[model samples]
Target chain A: MSRLAAVTGIGQTQYKSARKDVSMAGLVHEAAERAIQDAGIGWDDIDAVIIGKAPDMFEGVLMPELYLADALGACGKPMMRVHTAGSVGGSTAVVAASHVTSGSFDRILTVTFEKQSESNAMWALSIPRPFSMHLNAGAGGHFAPHIREYIRRSGAPAHAGPMVAVKDRKNALKNPLAHLQIPDISLEMVMESPMLWDPVRFLESCPSSDGACALVISNEKLASEGPNKPAWIRGMAMRSETMTCKGRDEVNPLAGSDCAKDVYAQAGIKDPRREVDMAEVYVPFSWYEPMWLENLGFADEGQGWKLTESGETEIGGSIPFNCSGGVLSSNPIGASGMIRFAEAARQVRGTAGEHQVDGAKMAIGHAYGASAQFFAMWAVSSEKP
Target chain B: MRDVAIVNYRQTVPVRDSGPVNELQMLEQVIQGVINDTGVALEDFDFVCSGSCDYLAGAAFAFVEGVEAVGPFPPIKESHVEMDGAWALYEAILKIRTGEADSALVYGFGKSSPGYLRSVMSLQLDPYYLTPLWLDSISAAALQAAQCLNSGTLTEADMAAVVARSRANAKSIAASQLKGDYSVAELLAEPTMVSPLRKHDCAPISDGASAMIVASPEKAKEWCSQPVMVRGIDHRIESSMPTLRDLTRSESTSIAGKAAGIAGVDVQFAELHAPFSHQEILLQRALELDDKVDLNPSGGALAANVMMAAGLDRIGHAASMIQAGRYTCGVAHATSGACLQQNLVAVLEAAQ
Candidate 1:
């Protein structure tokens, strides 16, 4: 028999271009302390600490968790650093929950961050590996061709990307911690923005930000004793495939579909669109919103764009998404995924102040990384399974 | 918790440099080699986890390229850690206990020769306080050695003897990076490379990869002729501040060892990830290993210090010994951060 796990508290730093005021330790500490305080517990309540980040090069610090141990109140406790690229945030939370499910620890503190301001992230990401392509564009450049293929395959309308960008920015107006809160966000403004990667406009892409996210996860026993209502973790799953494998579809990735299937199966959900009240999907690019919709089984293949055109993904719609502005409005790289997970929990707990989906019963949190090969996702609900 | 056992282990010969071979090529060889030893197909493993540092490769998402080694075509359940492979093993064990996976493939690799290992490791320190001072790893370790010496907790002879035994025991292993029949007195006579620590006192900078196959107890018995069961495993961390920790002793290791139930076990041999000579002594005392324990039978990291892979190598080496019937029970240790701020201890026993 496995022990149930729940998210008792969630915290995140204000996303920004540069967090110059705080060092890496201070940044993570800020989020961790908030989560502890929100949980109404002291640092001693945490049994272990798990941290995740995209890469050490982003902060020019190799395994910054070593330095962060003291700041996180992790001394004399077990600590592990996870690095599964952008999906690290989701995977790190999954690992923390698994520790509780394994009956090893009662309360676990999990955190993920990326201090992009510390170093030039574009340069760090574009470093030429031996025997690989040298004249490569950064992450956007690598994904542009794939976006073009997705457009070609789905035959999405020209206005779909602009429409999704405008929707997320509009939603950002409600999230005070969001990095990009454009007051006059509109489809016309997004279409007028310069195109950086052929079909993907500059406004459609996520901004580089420095931020951290933290969660206080506890076993069922401890969770029952917590001060606030808990978001019960229904299911969690992670999957990966090679960057270049035979017959792999980068547009509608198979790894992502498999991950969604596994997570939904674990949660005993047959129809995701009807069961999942809201979703906090990782939409780094505006176009990804529709593409992921089909991959996640929210809509049939070649029909996801219809949902976007109908505006059903907007707040107060049938299936609201990016209620917390999602990645397009604020991308802290590693913390982006955890922010989505946290948003899902917040909505379920009825604590999502401005952007709360009314009476959200179940929510989905998803993230992908590394040429869309790695996928991590989880399902959280207000009611225990 | 479910019973898990390691059934197969493999590692590349540690060398000063891997040249233009690259991380993917090195990892592929170990992955294929471990599969051959186990006689099990890659698709049979329920999960995969690897340990690597992208900083060593001078690129972000460098570990993503490592997926090519396993030919992840249909996709698989997997995870990666920006730490030593031993921690990856720890995660895999938890996956099995939680019934997430019945088996897992754990691997780690690093090429430290391309960059100055000491200066590169300096980046791992506290950036605001230590990195600004540009304190390299050797100097940091030398400070630890100086404190131990000044406190009368260790001596030059004790340090030299550790290196001498490592050299003598490692001479027969083909994967040994540095080995010879040297006397403790001769090692002591050599000029100190950094204060009280000599060149031999530190582990050599090596490039290598290691892999192991682990499965649940029932699956292990069905798949392998010999299996080494993971009896207990635990890890603990302390302050990153070198000044705050007791340099003369490893308090974190003691806490981890006790949590792993290292006490009252008939551990005949041990494999420790101690890159420095004094550290080996410090760890032995912390874990309460007496003279009966055969320390560093494979010369430990002193024989082949392959950064991210060495910690996993210690666990792999210990499991191999148990498989060979040379030892019925043993302990394997892995550590990270400055002066062993974090430590993982795993107690292994041969299947009866």
Candidate 2:
């Protein structure tokens, strides 16, 4: 009953520790303008705009979309703001797709960003609430325990985490816009890095960067006629659970699993390992690469680390993952998820210049947040369903 | 478009402060109330969405705590907006129209009592320009009222009449925080709190939460004997810079009203979310509504404005009136940003 939708354009600002060259509106405008240009459409063609960010506290602005309406050319148009924590970028894209798929609008421009330079994400995230103990130092401290639990349950080798860090960082060399471009990144270098969180080393964690990502989505008719090849959206889904609940499995969250199942079902994918040509998943920490591989059904419950250790996740391997360097290389918190989703679209559209997976016909994009209780995933293919 | 209707709606009484009852507890009560009233289990909802502001709670990821209200043990499909609950309902309508969901639970909450509500709202301005000025919300509205009065569009008595009518209507709404009968002459005699605006003209800072259950036509019939159909809904936004806009007129409201097909329907009664009484007058003229159309029958925002939830409350109140057979068709309006820069309009009608 739903109309088909596809991604006709994608744009991203260069990831950096601080985008001092541009203000918040200017940063977002850079990406939105690029996306609109890539889509070969004018501002008048867009029916609506949807923007997303991690939290207002990150930049000390409440409902920033209001102020940003002019910059994004959303004046006199339907504008919306979505917030689902770190997964907001992906969720924002899904909502934009809904604008087309629901037959409400023909074209929608979706944008997400985070200027962490404005404030400290660690302090914003770890603010002490009344009556609640503030034992967690930050996101790293909170997620480090879960990563350790995954190691204890999976029996992953000590080198597994370091290997992932090196692989992702090495991939960053091919991505010009990646925040971190360490040409000499190696397994030994990652292992020798300071141990920030016990099982997570300094090199294993993501960076706090300021950046923005944008996408232009349209219905089938306009998409087919667009100047560029469209990445047809096969399926999209979002799921969430309480942050902490009785018998919650933080390491292998059910919400992540259920989200993958729902998207795969809609995409008609029976075996994701075989059907999915590539993936760009949220791996803020190196350990999450394997944790999500298992949670997303790419490997058996306890065998996800084996896939990584086998070197099968490399670009020339069976299934290339995070070929764009992923969140580990460039994390703009709010835009991290959409960066994954955009990378997937690039692969399927044969537009990923240096990191393109050979003949990638189908790909998956995934992101999670809030103690791993929220999950958002989408499947895109070169061929229309 | 799918025939989505409001089957059940619930709200907690607006109060000056919730005290020990935190945001989660206030939202939980409303969510539970809607579920119990509609006899629909929590898991029955195909999707759940909520709207709230992090600044109101003065913390990051404050909405995460609201998830506990649904008891999401099984992990449900959900999304959230930083806008108002009316926008959450818009997302639900899109989901249902796409066949991704047949039923959705939408809610919004905010507690403005803990902080200086007026000063807290200034944070919504342009960070590089207006935010540095710390121009609070009240002063912003007062500026708009001055423009309206200077233009000779409306007098102080006209604004007072909106307050007088709102107070009289609040006598019927149990959730209303402020209610009293007063003539326009009596209201005009009161001291002006913000130059051109009186204290009664501004919406009371109240803490509350509201929830609504919307479903497809089939599910609506199965859930409730009386359902108010959402005829049409649309929202629009103008420039954020106050200097770029005409504060005397709500252009966005007029655009959204036309897009929502208000001209095609004979709206009998209406509920409008205008934090300030002068805004109600601007919105009425923007929507092109005549005096025949009843406005703010539930006292509107001036009586009990619950920040993020007040917009949805307008739609909920209008739907409730339709269900009660007070009128067959009505229009519900919600506004955001200073001087009604962003606006949403929804037309609700009883089942024909």
Candidate 3:
């Protein structure tokens, strides 16, 4: 008995290594103001605000929504802060959608941001623990071994990783807000980059960035009377598990598969490869593209690399991926997932100026975090459900 | 919102300093205790949501380890919030209202004794404008108390009376960290911890965890002996800047109270999350609770404040009163941010 919800406005701040020009409040306000303006409404129109971000250590500000309440126009309104590691951005949108679907609120503002320059994410992430050893490694170091394992099991060609890097960095040229823009990116240049983590080259890993993403969600009534073409939300889901339980599959997590299955069922999608026009998936490391493709049921186990190697994942291909350059090019950590979700909505609305996939009727957005144990996904369509 | 009820709730004794016990171990005790109290197996829950601050642990993604305590081997659907656990309950309630989940397990944990809590709380302020000045939590509350005192809205005796009553009521509750019987004059005579505020006027820095199981109406009837129904719940936040807000009043609490239908109805008892004694007065006035209502029956947070978990503890204590046949209906309030910048109000009732 859930009501219908739609995405009427999407806004994002320019991705950068350090947003030194503005404070944390200013950075989020930059995006939130744009979202409210794009929704063809004033700050008074929003009934609630839901914010998501990585750990509080990212900005040394605990429960940032408290400090950001006025900046995002959430004063005297129900404001929520979500944290699910990296997948929080996507989960935040799902939570916001639930408010509208449950007949709780009409228009809601959902925002996510991470100011990595405030403090060292690596130090915050790898602090010494009471019962555990000091890993002293960032996400790249932790994820590299999984990439090695994926290569060992799938026997995918070495070129698979480089190809993804070249495609996404080249795609960044079309996105003005993307952090990394390599107009002539090629496979050789990516392969020649220094090896930071064993299987993850320097160019294959995502950079530490400071940015924010904001979206305006509305119930059916307001969406129908909106000025812009709304991207109707068909379904959304979130799932999680222990980070490293016994007999856990890190490369292809069951939580991710379950999340995808639940969302597809709610969207009435039987065949994702044929039904989903394009996808914007979280891929901080280049190798994650194929790994997630298989885990998300787009390709069979041990065969997802073939999709990337055959040029089928590029724009105008059978099923395009990362058409807006995705997380590899512009990753603000906390906002990375929502950026993917926002890009999918932009595609369905035919508003993605340079990166829009032609005739994109439906699209999928996906994000994973916490050693691949937490996941969130959503589906949006041009036509109302 | 759909009809949801709190079937069971459990919490650890708030300790001034929880030695050697990590958050996971403390959470395991309550997670298992609440499930056992409700007679609901782990698999019976359709979703799990938790609240905790990583800054309290001084590590990033510290909550990720807590999922292990929930036994997420089968990969349960779940989410987490950075606010108090009361907000986690709000999300679970919405999930049931959406017909997406039937029942949920909500929990919150924090260990604030490891750090200088007064300074650690400063991190909740605006980073560029307020945090850099190192305005400790006590100083901020003192500012609000000064305003309330200057306006004659509150008196030193009123604040001491709150402390004396909290200490007396907390003695019967085993989970309370500080419990004693003292006169208002005796408390007022103590040396000031922060000018305009005495040591008894502030909550102790406690460490503990709390867990609650909420279910839809049908499920609640099948699972529990006495189910406490959640009538209406609403939460609102005010401007963060102290300069932009009226420090003497809680505008967010007043708004949330009305939205949760706290008007007209006879609210028999209350559990208010007031870490500072003066805040208790502001909340009482804001929610319009008169002398007839039994306030802070379990000592509220003044006896034991466990940071993130104390707010949810207030909700559970209020429902417990109704379930125990002491009151027919009650109001519970949880506040976050400095000087009660954010507030949540829930009205709980038991079937007559």
Supply every candidate's count of residue pairs whose N, Cα or C atoms clash at under 3 angstroms.
Answer: 0, 0, 0
Which number leads on lDDT?
2
Give the DockQ-based CAPRI class for model 1: medium
Q: Write candidate 1's Cα lDDT for B1-109 as tens digits.
A: 7888998988999899989887788898999998987788999999999998888887788888877789887989999999999999999998888887889999999
Q: Which pairs, if any, clash in model 3?
A: none
Task: For each candidate, give the interface RMSD after superposing the true interface residues on Cα.
Answer: 1.2, 1.0, 1.0
DockQ metric, candidate 2: 0.84
lDDT of 3 by residue, A1-385 (tens): 3889999999899998999998888999999988888889999999999999998987789999999998998998999999999899899989989999988899999999999999988888888878854557889989998999999999999989989999898788889999998887889999999999988899998888999999999999999999998999998999998877688899999999999999899899999999999999999999999999899889999999999999889988878899989899998888999999999999999999898899998899988887888999999999897
Q: Candidate 1: where are CA atoms >4 Å away?
A: none
**Model 1: DockQ score:** 0.80
Of 1 and 3, the candidate ranking higher by lDDT = 3
- Candidates sorted by DockQ, descending order? 3, 2, 1
Clashes of 1: 0
How would you order the candidates by lDDT, starting with the best? 2, 3, 1
TM-score of 3: 0.99
Native contacts kept, each candidate: 0.83, 0.85, 0.89
Interface RMSD of 1: 1.2
Q: Write the per-residue lDDT of candidate 2 for residues B113-172, one digit (tens) a residue.
A: 888999999999999999999999999999999999999989999999999999999999
